[model samples]
Target: MTRNFNYWSQKGVKGPSPSPMFGNILSYFITPRPHLNMQWQKLYGKIYGVYNGNKPVLMVAEPELIKQICVKDFHIFSDRNTNRRIHPILSKHLVVETGDDWKRIRSIVTPTFSSSKMKKMYPMIRQCLDDFIVELDVYAKDKGDVNVKIMYGNYTMDVISRCAFATKTNSHKDPNDPFIINAQKVFAPKVSRALCFMLLPTFVLKAFNMRGIAEESANEFFFNITRHVMKTRSNSQKKYNDFIELLMNAQKSSTNNNTKDVNHYDENDSSEAHHVNEGEEEKQVENKILSSVDKYITEEEILAQSWVFFVAGYETTATTLTFASYELALNQDSQQRLYEEEEKQAENKILSSVDKYITEEEILAQSWVFFVAGYETTATTLTFASYELALNQDSQQRLYEEVMTAVDSKGEIDYDILARLPYLDAVISETLRLHSPAIILIRQASEDYKLGDTGITLKKGQQLEIPIYAVHHNEEFYEKPNDFIPNRFLPENRHNIKPYSYIPFGAGPRNCIGMRFALMEAKLALAQVIKRYRFFRSPNTDVPLLLNKSTILHSPKRINYPFGAGPRNCIGMRFGLMEAKLALAQVIRRYRFFQTPNTDVPLQLNVSLAIRTPKRVIIGIEKRL
Candidate 1:
């Protein structure tokens, strides 16, 4: 029996009948959930709408619309629509906060990550990298096929913990550090994804939070570390230029200058005036003057921000580094070329004699490569680049030649020399274009806003997401968009690319702050690996890359190479990349990598927060003269 329904309204407004409940459920379970919105975009037009239960959601794919939400209308969409039930740990932190509170916190914390401060912290970063290299040497000497992914995570965790928190987390040495372990448990996608706290019903899931890793333990671990750092800084007579010092000073100044207490102020005000009869009174007042005009950050705020920094800085960098090694294993030619470049740079007579033997400057420069490229797109690029190289050896060899030539001219791998390697840069750019790390950048509307020519009004509290994976894969923007072709990033073709079409790190004020760092790290790592070793198709590797649907970052389902990309991206990207480069260089300089009979191609992938091989990435390693 057909029931007649009026489908069209007065102004050509068309509405389809409600979809069957079963169909919706089936769609949720079977389809790649991440791509579901993108699929809808194709069917319902760019600004299509959907309902997660009764909640209305609008998915925007048009670059301009995305830009407006993230940048132009940033005030309207500054909060991240974080699921409190699923991500209770991050609920009170800066990443999920909104409105004036976010602004104030960001203002106070921004100075901690300024370029000048980061430069000062480079020495500490180098120390972490040195430890990583020693660890790698131990692994290599054992002649055991190490899971590069796990090792990479350990390296980044150690670096970020020490550099950002000014604490000796020592995750590399103590793999079971409660903070590191609990932090990983917190982001486990399977558990977090199922808890979908963004929907209004998020409160219902809070009951289940008791079952997983105890939230208190994680919270305590983070807070204790922060409190220790804070107490040490506050009591110390000496001053240091670390992030902790900045926060401590800011907190003290804010607290002292606070005039909110009426009674206390009245008493202090009278005492000050009474003592101002002599010149000595003015001097005394001047000496007692506070640094700030207002009170803002509380102990809780400091602890919360510090916790966010650790969580944000560590896991992301670790994941990227893990993926980077996977890519190096697959792309031998690219790896060899990079290594040759490093060799050339090291041999350059222009550099100080001390630099040839790993001077602090050399370590700093090399370490930056690791930290910047360790995670985000660099690691993912390495993975995808290797996947393509393994599939298309011709392109891999061509890129190798370009890197080799570029490095040879300088006789060493200098920043300026590396920059001139167009083809190498192209290879890196192409990898980022295809396999961006974070597929979606989500923000919540803080106030009412309009988007695009449609003039659609987004109400306050609405969730905004920029589907980066969809944008990168859009056929209109890229020809044979699915195919891996490094040449697309070449100078001749790069100009043809449209603005905003490529946003691996996003764009504008909110774009990734760590982009330069990530890129440099990836280049150096890739350069070093390519110079020393060669890669071939491993039978153990999955032929077509399978993505781990659970992660925010587009992690692979199997062991893959390279790191991921973005700004507000990974802070340890430079450190991770350098580790990969150095490890690959040392190993490749001594041995060659080859596919073994035991190696599997078209291998199955285990999808999770980070990509992992179902089994070992079994390959034969042979010593080379």
Candidate 2:
């Protein structure tokens, strides 16, 4: 442990001195990671070291260095830092694979999220949003506190289930459904697997044959479910245009081609192969090459991919929605503008929408990775976007205007239209910048490499932490770094931003594979909700939104009960709560309220009635900015 502490110093690098055994864990535990990381960067400069229980991890935030590592020198940093003790089920996942394995699997899965494929899956997402809007309508009608996290979580889960497995689930209505319950457990495990992985030595964990990915039961549930779905789909005649079916088609195509090759021709007989189909064969070959990069993926890989989709798509996207709604609520003007954008678009056109591993333990690990990666990140993006929009109405209104203009004449948004909405895209980009789903990008050095002219040499096996949050907030990279400014992402201004500095989904070849899908999911939901209902601050709203990363569900917490207690509680409790909730939801969607010169700071009250009431009240209300 002492030797590990000296590891950085020996290489002439500067960092805070780590204490015995615990290293920087004490500080890490007490301080929030983003703040702590920013402090470290200030003190030790961009390139420094921090110890995670004597594991020397280099923190790199400098843009040029980051570009070199993530893009220019990607071959030397291809693999993510891992304990190499992955569960058997997850061992084969693309996220876990390195070098050739990663390349092969990535090629096979890349086409699954292509523009054409996203177009095919858009209707499924649209259907899910229709249900989502219904649920939101209930909230709007009842005027109750909204738990956007849980609401968006269910929506993303519905999307993943439908798109990944061709299975429709009522997650929006039945949050306790088995699919969600199991997926949630995988993400927020009952046990602190992350703590264990960070604190326990590999040898100690291996001695007990422990798997860190998920509870064995959850793994089994997904494994069995994925296999069953694949089996049932294979035997069925229905041509479902979902993710699993796509993989199955790839597998089937590969099998048929292999059989044909064995029976008819050798690899060298290109002429003979062409003769079989004539003119159309050339077009087919080109299409196949473009669409299906490789059809040689195995059943295990396909199953792993399915599991990953569930894990990855679930929470992240939901979190984004949660924050986006919260922001819209706080910034009523922005919410109104967004609503206008959607409404105007409605006047114009229609709305449309919208990974894997290997090993028994390895396969489970892949599923675990997918669920964790996809689920919360996108949701969190929407959540933060809402929160920021609520605070910054101008940005939201700009986004709305952009959305309105981008919609087709039918009032529908298709894949191409969604892609083209610059202002809408800017809002999401700025949202991602402010509340980046990923705090850091981890990479392990494959060989000894020199970092710039800083005289720092990264040894083989060194772990690199690209502090994304820090870089994003650095004033050098962004003006008024902390402020939410979606305009910065507009095409004309985007060129001014540094490359590798605004990486919410990372950069280079190994960046998040599900980025396109996540963006589409978030953009569609934002457009739909903003058009129909406006979000505004309520008494239950949390200002500045204290983020508890460990907690996935956001429920309103009320401290003061103005109506009194127990049997003496106000008779209008239910009616008041409903009236308040509904009024805020409906009114805020259309207008903005604030204090005026005529409004008294402390309104005169009449105590004659059973309940003290304001004698007279005055305030200003206006149409959305």
Candidate 3:
């Protein structure tokens, strides 16, 4: 791989000089990936290459080229480079699946996320948020330093478990509950790191029953619990309206399908192989794959996907809320105005689409997709929105007034009132642009593709990395790219922004499936919070926040713009947003947040992943008087 660095340079792929085991990591140590990518673009033009690990990754931010690859040439770059064909149930999970299997599974699972389904799940989410508020209220009365991240995480996990898995337990009250404990173990960084170990291949890891990739004890407990749950459901006379019911239907269909396939195949064929032509053989294979969809969504598959859902939803939502709490604490005037004006309006209504009467496995997989794509990113946006609001008071005040007016005219906030609060929406949009949850977007090439006008081609088997932070902060796309300005996304200024320059939930068909859900969640949460409490700077508050790494005072790129764009954007974007917005709304209306002795102002963000979460954002609380 080191040998190919010069080879790429000869082919007009100009980038940084790689050094030893560090490769370009030292440059990342200097700055974030996006900033470094933007710098490289200036040195070697827009279309360039840089070494990440042992591979040379193409980094391009120009819109037209992005459009061609993500929209037009999607088929050639249909799969993600990280999509290895591993053995675990994780491999069967859609996030990493490529080509036909991906398409097939996607089709089946799409319906479970439809507006109607989300509507059914809304009550559960609301219940979770309500429970969350109760806890916050206690903290406010006690004047305790609230660790909102942990609180929000527990809240989100409860909601996902209820709506997605048909279980309800207060995770915060009983931290040792199997659901909470195993979830931590399964999604722990060590487990994730273990999964990435090249030495422990998927089959070997599975064969040896290594708990490193997935905690064996936790996995077994969950599997047993699921089996029992299913058995109880089978005997129960009452029907349920949650995800469990939807998946159980799929399980029934799968059971019926396996029986039919076994019987039909035997009676219809004398010989299985020698007599068939290539075309006939292809048809058989296709039919078998479809049959397997039903066949696989069994008890084992259901349990596997439930873990996926738990792992994805648990932390991401909690972390984002924590950040928002911090931001609200720092910007008291804006918080005060929001409290005065927004005693107010709006329900959330999202546009467009998800699935057929999909199989049990497919439905379960889709739920996982919803959780993974939706939760953390939405939470991060809420965090950033709070941060920016604290930093930029005028925008926060404007949004607060708008929310107040809408609520004054209408009843309690619902989607209708939310529609009138454009400034509020704008604030959320700006936050997403600046602190998009997903960090780097990646794609693999199945065929060689060309860069627009540059004539430099990306070869088959090559990978491309889009530096989200760089593009979002690039001066070319946004004026005063580093500033926290919500007006940039106002209707008048929105159209002037370059195409693909502002993808918070990404762009294209393969973009985040849950985009609208996340948006709805964030808007609602912010609206409620803005109206109830005044967030003011305290002794613990730090001015001009800092990421975990060094603070780059003068960023070279455009302003705002986050999430990713393209065929493989986050799938559960809307769902996550909805949860975040609602949760924030409920808490803000009831209590005021303040900086505490424990509050770490000018937060040091964790640079390990894309989301800019603080190592800790402990905040003080007071019941709004």
> Candidate 1: deviation at residue 568, Å?
9.0
Per-residue lDDT tens digits for candidate 1, residues 1-625, read 1112222222232222334332132343333434554576566665555443343455566766665565455545655664452443233345444455544444444444443444455445545555655565554443434433344455555655665466566666887777567656544524433434323254466665642223556555655666666666666888656545656655655435533321111111111111111133322232232212233555655565555444444433333333333333445554454344344444442331100011111112211222222332333344444344433444445544444554444323444344335555555555555555555666666667666667566677776566666777788878998665655665566656665667655543333333333443444444443443343445454544455444345544443221211112232333333322322233333333334333334322333222222222333232323
Q: Is candidate 2 or candidate 3 better by lDDT?
A: 2
Error of 2 at 58 (Å): 0.6
Report the C-alpha lDDT of model 2 over 235-282, residue by residue, as the tens digit: 799977766666666566554554221111112112110011112332
lDDT for 337 in candidate 2 is 51
Candidate 3 error regions (>4 Å):
25-46, 142-145, 191-231, 234-240, 249-308, 323-360, 367-371, 397-412, 415-420, 542-563, 591-601, 618-622
Q: Residue 137, candidate 2: how far off, in angstroms?
A: 0.9
Score each candidate by Cα lDDT: 0.44, 0.53, 0.52
lDDT of 3 by residue, 519-624 (tens): 4455556665555543333444343333432111111010011445554554454455555555555445545556544445455454433444443445555665
Clashes of 2: 83
Find the candidate with the highest lDDT and give its number. 2
Give TM per candidate: 0.70, 0.78, 0.79
TM-score, model 2 to reference: 0.78
CA lDDT of 114 in candidate 3? 49
Residue 249's lDDT within candidate 2 is 62
